[model samples]
Target: MRPDEILIIDRDTVERCLAKQDPVALVESMLHHHAAGGTVLPAEGYLAWRNGVGAYTRAIAMLGGSDTSSGRTYGMKLINASVSNPGLGIERAGGFTVLFDPETARPTALVEAGFISAERTAAYTMSTLRVLGPAGFDEVSIVGCGTIARAHVRLLHRYFGAVRRIHVHDIDPERARRFASDVTGRFPEYTVDIHPDVHSCVSASQVLVTLTVSDEPYIEAGSLRPGTFVAHVSLDDLRPEVFEHAQAVYVDDLGLVCDNPRRILGALIRDGRVAVPGTSDAPGSGPGRAITGAYGDVLRGALPAVRPDDGFVVSNPFGMAVADVVMGRAVADLARAEGLGVMVDLLGAATRAGGAA
Candidate 1:
C-alpha cells in the first residue's frame, strides 16, 4: 500500500483483530503512557439535540495521541448516539476512528469505532477493577443489559475466572432475560440471575457496573453495600450522595472530568460538592467529598489500591480518547499485517487534478 492510500477497516475486520488482541493490556499501557506524560488529550467536542421523534441524540468528537513502544500515533473518534435507535431496531451508538501519520499528520486509516469504543471502555473497566475491586468475588451485578453491558460481561468471563454468577437488573425485564440468554449461550459455566429491580441487584453484587443512558441519577447510596466496587460507566446513574459517601472515587482524568460540567462528578465539582484533586481543599480535607486521584496514579503506585476497609469505592471513567486511538492503531496494524481491509486511494483524485492544472 502507498503512503497516500488510506486503509478502511470495516467492523468485521476490526472485531477479528480485537478478538486476537488483549485490549486490557492495551488500555493498561495507555494508562501508564498517559501517566508518564506521553499522551495528548484535548477537551472533547460535544453536541446534543432532540430528534424529530423527541428523542435525545448527541455526537462526541474526541481527539488524542500517544507515544508507546509500538510508535507514536494520533487519532480522533467521532461517535454519535440516539436514545430512540434501539426502538428502531438499530444500535444506539455508531462511529468511526481516523488514525493519522505521526510525522506527516495525514490520515492513514479509518476504522469502525463503535465496537472498538465499547471494547476499550470495557477493557478500562476491567483494568480499573484489578486495582479497585474486591480482592476475590464470585458474584457481579450489572445495571443495564445493553451493548456496553454485554462487552463488560464478555471481558469478565474472559479475564476474571473467579466470577461464577452474574446478577443483572434492567428496567425492561425482557431485555435482561435476553442478555442472560446471550451470556449463557456463549459461556455455559456461568449462572445469570435477573432481578426485579436495581435495589435487589445492588444488594447482591460484589461489583456493580452501570451501563444505562438515563438523564437523571437513580442509584442511591443506601443500595450499595460495604466493599462494593461500582464502575460508573454511564455518568448519570449514581446520585450525588453516592459520591459524597464513597470510600474513594477515581477518574480517568482529573481535568477532563472536572472540565465537563454535564456529568455528575463534574457537576459536583462545579457546585462545590466535590473538591478537585491537587487543590488546597483536596478531597477529604474539606467539608465536601474529595477525588482520590486518577487511575494512572494507582497504576504508577502514586495512590493505594482499594482495601477491604474502603467501603463502596467508585471509579468514574470519563472515557479517554487516547484509549480509543491506541486500540484503533493496534487494530489497524494487525489488519495491515494480515492483508485485511480495503486500501483506498483517498488523495489520488486531488493529486491528479493538481497535475492536470
Candidate 2:
C-alpha cells in the first residue's frame, strides 16, 4: 500500500518470461497446472483492421471449480467475443478471454483479459517455434499485419535473430508498407519489404507465418515452395484442401488435433474428403497407423518430417486453459512477490465467513 512499492513489468520483462518457457513445457505445464487444481478463464473478441467494413465486440468468460481434495480441477472454457481481427494478411482478430480462480476464492487482482489474450497466444506460437527449432527459419513470410502479427515479428526477431529479408503482405497494401516502415524503423537489423501479392512472398519463404480473420482461406498449397515449413498462428486460416496432401501434420498435441483439428482437417475427415492418418480403419485406410504416432513419439524421434513429395507440412495447436492457468498463476506470483497487483483487504473477512475452509 506504500508508494515505495513498485510493480515492475514491461513488454521486455514479459518477453523474458516468455523466452524462458518452452512450448512442450508450456503444454505440459498446463496439463500439470490443471492437474494441480488450476483453471482458465473464457475468451471472446473480434477483429477488424484498415477498414470500417468490419467491427465487433463481445463478452466472454469462464468458470473454474477447483477441487484441491481430489488434486484435480474439472472445468470448461468458452468464447463470447465475436469481433474478428481485421483481415490483415497475418492476423484474424480473435478476442474472447476467460478468468480463472479457485472453487471458493475471492478476487483480489483482476488481470485484463486483453493482455492475457496476447500473452497466452504468443506463448502458444513461440512455444511451437521453440520446439520446432528456432534456427529452422532462414527466410520468414508474415502474411498479415496486426497486433499478433507484429508480436510474431518482434518476438521471432528477439528469439531467432532477424529473419533474412523479412517479407510482409496483407490485403491492405498501405498497412503492409506501414508495417514494414514501422518495424524497420524500430528494428534495423532486418530489412523489411512489403509484398503487393501473397504469391511472391509464399513462393520464396521457407518459414511462412499467417494470421488472418477472413473466413475465406488466405493460404493455398499450390503456391508454397517445396521444402518450406509453415507456422500457422491463426486457428481458422486454411481451407479444406490446404492440407490435402501435406507431407507432415505437425501438432503440439496429436490428441487435441484429433479431437478438434482446424476446419480444413475437421471438414475433410467429417465429410470423407480425406481421412485422419491414424484413426481410420475404414476401407480406404492405407497406413498402419497415423502419420506420426503421437507427441511422445515425435519427441522420441519416431515421427519423421514429411518428405518432399508429401506436398505440405503443418503445425496445429489447440491451447489448453490449464496452461493459461499456470502462466497466469506464475504471473500472479510474480506480481505478488514484487508487490505488483492490486491487493485486497481480506483481513478477517474469512473469519467472518466461519474461518478458512
Q: lDDT for model 1, on a 0 to 1 scale?
A: 0.88
Note the clash tally of each candidate: 1, 35
TM-score of 1: 0.94
Identify the candidate with maximal TM-score: 1
Runs in model 1 deviating more than 4 A are 282-286, 308-310, 347-357
RMSD of candidates 1 onward, in order: 3.9, 7.2
Residue-by-residue lDDT tens digits, candidate 2, 1-357? 222222223344344444554533544455334433353334422232333645554443344433232243333233334344444443332322222333433332333333444556655565555545324565688888767677776667665764657888888787787788888788887788788888887776767777665555767778887666666666666654555555666555444455553344544455554555555633332222233323333444555534333255666554444454444444544555544433333442211111212
Residue 240 in model 1: lDDT = 89
Q: Which regions in candidate 2 have their CA more than 4 angstroms from the true location?
A: 1-28, 31-108, 133-135, 253-262, 281-311, 344-357
lDDT per residue for candidate 1 within 1-357, as digits (tens), equals 457878888899999999999999999999998988989998889899999999999999999999866899899999999999988877899999999998788888899999998999999999988888888888999999999999999999889998999999999898899999999999999999999988999889779999998779999988988889999999799998988888899998998898888898898888778887766554442257789988988998888887435468999998998999999999999888777887777666432211222
